[model samples]
Target: MVDMDLLLALASHARYRPDQLAVAFEDERLTYRQLERRVSQIVAAFRRLDLAPGDRIGIATYRGVDPVALYLGSQAAGLQPVMLSWTLGPALPEMAEALGVEHLFVGAEAAGLHNLATSGAQVWDVGGHTADIGGFLAQSEAEDERWIVRRDPDQVSSVEFSAGSTGRPKAILRTVRSDVWNAWQRILAYRACEGDRWLCITPMNLSVLSGMVRAVLVLGGSLVLLERFDAARTVAAIRDGVTILPLQTPHWSQILEQPDLGDIAEPRLRTAVAIGQRIPVGLARRITAAFPRADFVVSYGTSESGMITALSATDPAFGTPSCVGRPLPTLEVEVVDEGGRPVPPGVRGDICVRGPSVVAGYDPAVGPIVSSMYDDWFNTGDVGQWDQRGYLYVIDRRSDVFESEGQLVFPGEIQEEVSRLPNVREVAVAGVQLEEECQATVFVVSDRDNPDIASIASIEAAVARVSQVSFRIRSVDRLPRTLGGKLDRVALKRGQW
Candidate 1:
């Protein structure tokens, strides 16, 4: 059996590699020795709080050194950190209720912040309690290591909430086995290694935090986190040698188009992975052109399924910018019809997967997200098909599929087609309800010099070529986006601008 104590493993890595840099902030670098000491003190601090092993603590803090300390310290204490978004401060009580969290570790800014309060939880301002983790480390003693609990691989390591595409976010309880294996899958597939630097520009609350924190810590890599995403800072980070940077499509696309990256000097920078949303074909091509030496990869997955698909420069179909790469190691992807039988090559069907990275189920699990598992396989709710050469291409979310004038329309297909139009930076397609049913409507970001009408006409011509055209077009200054920077299709359909 595998010894699944991440804290123990971290401590061991520190003991064996004391001189090696374990983490780095802007100007300060921490060696393994420093990290171990900090972890010890943080564990001591946890004892001061009177929290015990298996106690659920909610971590609602900003991204930076402190958040990382809280994460590691909680693990050291065998406390599961239920990570909550700072934006959802209003919903903390409900969220805490959902996760059964009793103790809250919040930031200084959030001391009095609460729209609703949990019945039996105490909120501690982590910022006020521990300003300098390294400083705290100086006082730590071997006796300070007050806890070393048995770790079951299956025991919940974290409780993450999924951005409910349909409605309210769903709480997901994840195990140490799934979390560690998922981190390894990313490392193996992406070739992440020691000394490689990663920047946390994505939301501190969700997928990026989940995948990145573990990957950076366990692999002895450095994580440069941003308080929020600033395009210039991103470009600067890439130019100044932040390798292995991952971003949502929109953010990375904008970064590539920035002229600033052309002048930055960094030899160690190598790969850039774009996740969260579909990368525009033109944007991907431009990004590759901009960073000639960088390995450009497009990743596809959800909060429920950690990185099920990855498209890398080495894939044979990598030339097709719309294809989001083949399934990475530790994942099995299949396209199935309504009857649950596998679809033929190039035929559209629901994309399903069986894998170690996939969440076993969700909390208060309902419907197919929980029950549709055929043993290990999961219905992904995404419509896709594999090519004869086995390249998986996601078409669209099955729930987003709509019929227009008796012809089935996949919103993704339209978005993909329009994404290739010249000067059209990005696009989101949603079906607007009419008298009886829904009709496709497109939203786009394009060069201000050119009217969106021209881009729409181009899309109309392409749709006509496929003979599946039946939609209207509307242009806005900017498309509404989710906190993660994905196009907010649901909000668009609801007439929320």
Candidate 2:
């Protein structure tokens, strides 16, 4: 394999497979030829604004063709593109300015649009690829030296902002080589091929989405996107010629609960990947049965490390929430103690990993998650243990674990046991403070369309077997999730329970 950037790879694919579909979002489609042209147009627009190479541009648009177009356009013209959180509402403009993003592309309907008028950066309304940006693209001529530019391997290729489920977010800057390596990593992990079509259910701004898009496009494969994750829409997409499907833990049970899911036989699904959070065996088994032709896998990693380990449901040892399978072939993973010494098998300790595509470090100024960004092995801040068979199990995030009766309590342990309860659709557990006491709260949603939820006494009885902590079980219609469709633990801890 040769070292290649996403932009260079795009040009190669466009040159050979001009008629192949490159991206699909809703009813909008872009073949390789059309995607290439739109990227060129975006490059021209950037040049017309006199933006120089290495200039950082911001993309504050909703999910659609434009964000990918802008990303390719900037990188092809030798610039760095950062995906800003459009959900920030009024706080977006100030956040954009703090990052030194001079030229911004603001979607007309983006939630941050209300505050765009007062921003220091130049803003453009290109919602659904309409407005002045469309006019600029319509006037650009195709095929010029502007189609490609010299890019340093070490240059910043993309900047990904973490979801900050812990507290505050951090900016993870990846270089051209690093980004390319990560794309290749996902491609290898998912066994992507030229004919594969990935259905991206996650938000476009997510770090995982960036790699998945590149992996598909780099292989001349097609990408189908959803504005957001919906169980009905996702099930419909899978039945309609989607070869690969990836979703978070919370999204799986919902898809299985879809009344229409069992009516359709979606044999076209070749791979089903579960990420974001752990998948209980029961949920994983249901998912495995749902996609008879697909391989169900659990992908475990962090923004700092690109896909450290993936456990297929087929693995004989895949029955626990923490069993994340073995480390990927290209990385080094170790369970270290408080003194930084490697622990023996079955010993729980800090998880440290370093390898290709692993981020070099975070921007030191983004002090929110600096504890994990030190030199050498990146401390994942996750408590983990390695079984005698070389299988790794992630115990819990060090920060998420709480003390109860002088014993460390893992929220995942409680959630996993409660997830096994009958008629319990979705459950999220977190340690919260209520009247000077730390309480383990289990926010649950019932599967049946009835006001009655799972028995609280039964849930309490189930969790009592797992830990001694007192849990306050609350039945809610649904759990609050982030734009990425992940359980927003940060919000749940902030009295949102």
Candidate 3:
């Protein structure tokens, strides 16, 4: 059985490798010893405030040392840490209230952006001129160190909110056993080791972020944190010998377009995992070409089910259409039709998964929508198919597929085709309802400042080559994306452009 006490491992690291670099952010660096002390101090402060187990502690902060400390401290204290994204803006307070957040930790830099006080949760500033964390650490210095609180393995340790593109975000609960097991899978899939230096380009609000962090720390590896993504900075860091780099598709696209990318020397980067969305074949090729020494991998999973599939660079099906690779050895995946019967190879059906890593269920406040438990298996609203060899291929969200002219149309297929166009910077395909029938429409972001009609026509022709069905092509300066860097399809369907 796996030991779910993550803090014990962290404490061990501090005892043996106290001086080893644990985290790096810009010019700042923290050693394992420092990280352990900081986390302990935060835990003591939380105890002094009378916060108990099961109390929801909400955290909304820019990527930095303090945010990491807060997360570890909360988990060690048995408090459920609710990660909040800044993208919520003014509506953040309302969501916090819905989550029953009792205390909040906000980055000093982001304090001016939202009035979280109205949520009635006591707020603590972390880092910046305010130095709230520093004060807390100072006050707790003389207090006895509190041992890590141990809870039932099945109890919820953290709460993660969905992207909420369609409506209110759902609260997904993650248990200690599930979280630790998921992290182990990632470590195996990404080839993470004690010597590896992992780069984190996304915010910690993402479930993947915590898993990555935990995996690295547990293995005595170093984590290089960035407050925000900058293509040049990321490329520079890779050249400086970072081994593992995990980025979303959009980040890869932006970095690929950088003019200085070609000037950088061959990077020391070994593994690069594309998270959040599928990596277009064309983009994947470009990425491989840029970092000849790196492995370009595509990973797929949901909040309800921790990473289920991963296609390594060496896998022959890496860039194959809809291919997300075989399910991990730890999990079982199946595709079934409406009647709950297994589908044949190459046939489309709902993707169902069951494993120790699967989340128990969503918090009661968030209605049951994306995931449903049936016979010990969780039905992931995503539709997919499996090849003869058992490789899984995700088509699209069940709701995103629509009927056009009595023919089933998948927006993801159209989007993938349009994404191949050289002039198209980004594309989102959606089925628009017309008077008599529904038709597919492609929203394009151009590569040039002002794309002429000729360029637009070229993209249209390229899309037509892959999809015989007629589609209306429109250009937009920018495409809306969720905080997790996924295309906001719900917004596009509502004509929010």
Candidate 4:
């Protein structure tokens, strides 16, 4: 039987490959042995603070080995780690309160009010730990005789907050078992093996962190963490032997469009996992052409579900350049209608997911949950349909669907076709009430050039080719979006400029 505690894996790896690199931060490197010793000390030190099992602890820090160490050590000590984004700003206090954290750690200059640190919380200055990591890890300490948690595969090991673009972000708790399973699945799908180095581009607070990091460690690989998104630096890290990288759509687009991106091309990269959103077809083709050594995977998942489905390099449909692909082994996906009944293949409906990784629930106080399923399945807010070959196709959110000319129009569908035009940089579609009744309106973003009647007519033709005949397209210079990167259609409908 597999051991329930994830810490044992780290301990074992440390003993086996003490000198092999376990992690790296910029120029600094820490071997598996060094990581284990440091984590042991950190766990023992926290135990001295009298923190009990199931206690929630918050860590406000940037991406680095120290933050990752705290995350691993907290779980080893039977504490739940809540990672707050560095950009959380004034909301940090409110978030800590919402997560019910009693212990907190603030890194560098990001620490907020001290009043929230309960009597149980022993805030540590990570800045002090950074200067002498070796000294900190080398301290001798007797093993605490405290009870170690034999984790249930279903029990949550960490909590990640959602971006909550349409509303306030909510804390999403996931199980350690699911984390391991998902990581393993990704490793198999991407063909990532030992010695592979991944440049982690997404924030550590994201739910994907646990799976991605665990996958790398399980394969005896290395992770290079970045503080923030920098196109040149990211490419350079890849050039310097980082084999796998998780890239976002916007950032990848920026890199390929930049005149200088090709200057630091890396040949060691085997694959690039593009998550967060669909990559524009044009950009995907360009990335593959530019970097022939690496394969590009279009992945789909959320904080609630780790990696539900992914498109591999060799799949026949991988070149479709739009679909997210078939579901993973552990995941079960269904396209359901408004009545919660399963819709037939080739028909659009809400995408419902059920699996080990799906979260149990969200906080009701934070916001209304309009998309959760009534049954065991977790309803993804997205509207999608399964093709004849069982490939899932996402249309748009149900709320984002609006009636134009007495028919339904999905913004995602229009946006996809509109994005095909060369001049269009970004596009968002919303329904506006032009008459006494509501009608569809499309927002378009183009560079410098004003869209003439001919250009507008061409867009109308494109919409007519795919959309319900009643809907019409409206040309606008800009569209609003929430901080989480989702289109702010609600504000647009309310006539907000």
Q: Among these predicted structures, which one has the highest TM-score?
A: 2
Ranking by TM-score: 2, 3, 1, 4
Scored by CA lDDT, what does every candidate get? Answer: 0.70, 0.76, 0.78, 0.69
Supply candidate 4's per-residue lDDT for 158: 73
State the lDDT of candidate 1 residue by residue for 174-286, as single tens digits. Answer: 77777877787777656688768888764636456767768877776767767677788787777666888788777876676666667865446688788767776667777
Q: Candidate 2's residue-wise lDDT over 1-497, tens digit each?
A: 22345666677778888888888888788988888877877788777878888788888775677777787787777777777767666766776676678777877656436667566887776766433463546666654654477776667777775636654766788777667777776776665677798988757455666787688887878888787888898888887878878788888877887887878864588888888677787888888877777887788887777788888877888776668888888788999999899999988999999776777666544444456754658888889999999999888888888875567788888878888888888887777777776777788888766556778899999899988877778888788877777777777876574
Query: Once superposed on the true structure, which residue ranges of model 3 sit more than 4 Å away at CA?
Result: 1-5, 113-115, 127-134, 142-146, 366-371, 433-439, 448-468
Tens digit of lDDT per residue, candidate 3, span 169-262?
Answer: 6778888878888888788678777778998865636566677768888888888877778888998888778999888888898988887888
State the lDDT at 490 in candidate 2. Answer: 77
Off by over 4 Å in 1: 2-5, 16-21, 24-30, 108-112, 128-146, 164-166, 202-204, 365-372, 434-437, 448-455
Better candidate by TM-score, 1 or 4: 1
- TM-score of every prediction relative to native: 0.90, 0.93, 0.92, 0.85
* Clash pairs detected, candidate 2: none
The residue-level lDDT of candidate 1 at 23 comes to 58
Question: Which residues of candidate 4, in runs, are more than 4 Å off?
Answer: 1-5, 112-129, 132-148, 264-266, 363-373, 404-406, 431-454, 468-497
131-178: candidate 4 lDDT, tens digit per residue: 554333344463532434666666767777664555456666666665
Candidate 3, which ten residues in sequence have the lowest lDDT sum?
Answer: 127-136
Misplaced by over 4 Å in model 2 are 1-3, 109-112, 130-138, 143-147, 202-204, 364-369, 449-451
